[model samples]
Target: MAARHSRKLLRPLLYTSAAAAAGAGVLYISYRPRNIPGLEAPAVPPPGYREGKLVPPSFPSIKSRLEQIQDLKRSNDEEEYDLLIIGGGATGAGIALDAATRGLKVAVVERDDFSSGTSSKSTKLVHGGVRYLEKAVWELDYNQ
Candidate 1:
């Protein structure tokens, strides 16, 4: 008699638990950050790291400031140029190329060599955030 009553309660409890689990799975898949007003754009490559087949970033120890940047006029034989580029990083390089192509005299200066700053320290993969693998691992463990 007691066993029969226990079974009756168990059936409904199991059904409720299964429904809740299914609902959670559905929510996890469908939900993602949509339009959060005033939220800043995510980082180019996120903080952690990544592994791939590409030339890794290299850094110098104590940069004693390049002469070209410190004394622009001294480095240059000409008085002035049409465009004076600030850094020799990727963006700056692109700017210089564009200006030069347009028949404008251009000069680019960098405290260090090309991409020597943070840009130089990139891990090859262009369109990915750094913590991608970590996120994947987390998602795998995080059962909805």
Candidate 2:
């Protein structure tokens, strides 16, 4: 008898919870920033990317996002890209950026989260690449 009463109560609670969820969904859809005046929608680029800077994507967690990406790679047959980079280190990322800027179909695959590898592992000073640079040349490096 108590189980029956509990089940009866649960049915209403579940229905109410679902209704609340649907209402929240509708509220979210109706309250988007793009629906407001003088607001621009978010930018999404071709082949699953945002056309923008070097910043890591905003996510709940970098590790979780990377795991999701790995799942996608395992499940989906990706498009044939002109450039496929294997890491998110500085050199790999630079190559990806260069190819993308040149209007090529570039996709970079980082094994770990962005900057989790040799890119940030360097102990050298930031400007150590081109040492003793000529002032007039507009190129400076300390490694020269």
lDDT of 2 at 143: 43
lDDT for each candidate structure: 0.66, 0.64
lDDT of 2: 0.64
- Relative to the true structure, candidate 1 reaches a TM of 0.31
lDDT of 2 by residue, 53-129 (tens): 45554543345675756755765455556777887777767667657666577767767766675744663332343
lDDT of 1: 0.66
* TM-score of each candidate structure, all chains considered together: 0.31, 0.34
Clashing pairs in 2: 130-141, 130-142, 131-141, 131-142, 131-143, 131-144
For candidate 2, what is the TM-score?
0.34
**lDDT, residue 74, model 2:** 63
